[model samples]
Target: MAVLKKQLEDMRGIRYDIASLKGSISNLKTPTARQFVSPRQMMTNGKTPTKRSTPNPIGVGPSCISRKKPVRGNDPRKSAARTKARRRILQGKQISEDMMAALQMEDLKQLCSMHNVRYRGMPQARVALRKIPGLIVSDTEDLPNRSATGEEVQGANMEDAQSVESESEEEDDDSSEEAEYFEGPEASKDVQPSAH
Candidate 1:
């Protein structure tokens, strides 16, 4: 009789499980409806997804993806330094040799660039600094040692042309002297009494 009661209790437990399962099935969404929702939406329970403002993010959409980082022309710190140097120049305090000597090569370059002074091929920073003053004071557009006066350029070109001509003439004279030396000796030797 105890065994029979135990079997009845087991049967009741199985029946209760079946009823709970039916209730859960009724509350659950269909697979087709679940298929319509994105995995993100499903994970979020149909809530709006949050956006991250970082350059790289979890979701890689077309709009969010970038092949390369955006490039900035000038760094803020460098620009600030340039502005400070400019202000110092305006005050007529930083143009002194001692003040310029105190500045680093990079600082001098920034100063040159700020004033649009051409200093690309300058060998020394002091040389570049010297150009900045002429650029500021002179009304002329050209930088010192960059473009010469028209007459100066023409004179230089004429000098170069004359030197080349002189070099060519010297080479011609040397070649003629060598020809005479070689041919004269050979002809004299050939004219020697031929053994009959």
Candidate 2:
């Protein structure tokens, strides 16, 4: 019975020593410190964020927005002239042969319809041409010198005719002076006519 008691005491001492050793080992252990990062290290390690570049919108800057004036289309004067021509044709006034040649087929049709004129064959074309005033024949091979009736006539060149008319006026003045001088002397000579 005394040996059994001694064995129990030895077992108890062994267990107590084991428990103390475990507690000392736990106290020696320390928590590892957290790692700190520097700016240079962060950039090198691809951890830093970067900003992205963007494109500007159109018509924003002075170079793009402050431009010169925009381009223009056809002249208004030309359109007004065309409109006036159309109105005259619609009023049943005869269009000149020259003007008729200048107009397109569509214009002719419009003019005829507006004036309520019946457009017949080619023969009526001549009749229509004679009715319009202010129309001069254009100098084109297709349009020969002809009256409204399509009769071939020797039409004088407008420029040449004007020059000739001015010259004729000067000649008429010279002839009138000559006539007065010859008539004054010839009146006395006729009264004494007997030296035959």
Candidate 3:
């Protein structure tokens, strides 16, 4: 009789658990009035949203900005130094020891650009700046001094171009001469003897 009574208590406990599970399932399927919240109120937190002047499809705000180019312009002091160097060249004057000593690495680079000298990978130091004048002098060696009418400058340009062409032609001739000297043996054609 006691065993049957314990089984009855166990069955009652299981039924109570099943009843609680069904109540929770019904509550989930049909939400209560307190669970229903308007989306506008939830998003804005019960406050009115601000209006936008334009539609931002990309979502990039105006506050996030960037510059495409450098803020600094070509340094005026560097330009003045280059002008001085050009004047010296026009006067048929050499880059003096005093002038060379005064210029910085940046000034040397500016001067190099003005004279069309390839300054890439060149050392950026006071001592290295000394070699730049030799390159400039070599480039402008054949150039004439400045004239009243500026015709000498134009003439100098033409002469420079002609000299460049002659150098290239000389190089081409040297290559052809090398090819002649290094000529390979010609292959002999294999002819079949007459079948007759």
Candidate 4:
């Protein structure tokens, strides 16, 4: 009789489970609960699915100024002291003696003009320019020097044209001299004592 009662309790539990499942199915069918239901799986147009188009969210689009963007705070000149002139400036050193001594009369004049220093001649200009603080030498000290004024440039151009013409004449005279030096192994052997 106890086994029959236990069997009856199991049968009741099965029925209760079926009733709960039916309730869930009914809830799923309701319009309010079915709000999240996906649209019908039927394809649009010619029954093909299409991916939605989206703008690239990464880098700048077509409006970017240059393809190579300047990364923030990455100046190579600043990072590496590539030049002695740059290193000197960074160290806050005064005018280098070599640069100061190498300074031409024109350079001193230019410096004196910058500081509004009045000087009679090259010596006075050099002295006055040396006295001024924060005088800077150009990084391109090795570059071909140019005068500050237009008049000087005009005179220089005339001189250059004349020199070019003169050099052509000099080249003609030197051609015979150059030929002796270009006699291959014979010329080099002449410089030696003939290896007695």
> How does each model score on lDDT?
0.57, 0.58, 0.59, 0.58
Candidate 4 local accuracy as lDDT?
Answer: 0.58
TM-score, prediction 1: 0.21
Candidate 4 per-residue C-alpha lDDT over 24-136 given as tens digits, one digit per residue, 9 for 90 to 100: 99878545554453454647553545578778788757665666878886655533432443344345444443455555566566556656899998778767766765554
**What is candidate 4's CA lDDT for residue 169?**
73
Model 3 residue pairs with clashes: none
Question: What does candidate 2's lDDT look like per residue over 47-87, in tens digits?
Answer: 76566756669865544566666458545555455555566
Q: Which stretches of candidate 1 lie over 4 Å from their true place?
A: 1-87, 90-94, 120-123, 134-196
**Residue by residue across 25-116, what tens digits does model 3's lDDT show?**
88786554686554654444665455568766796778757676644856666556656665674564565444454455666666566565
Q: Whole-model lDDT for model 1 versus the true structure?
A: 0.57
Q: Which regions in candidate 2 have their CA more than 4 angstroms from the true location?
A: 1-54, 57-108, 117-137, 140-161, 183-196
Top model by lDDT, which number?
A: 3
Error of 4 at 114 (Å): 1.0
- How many residue-pair clashes does candidate 1 contain? 0
Listed per model in order, the count of residue pairs whose N, CA or C atoms clash below 3 Å is 0, 3, 0, 0
Cα lDDT tens digits, model 1, 1-196, are 9999999999999999999999999999877644465556543466657766767576767675658665686555555655655566665433434345445567667666766666554356457657654333222222112233443221124555569989988887777666566776436554332221
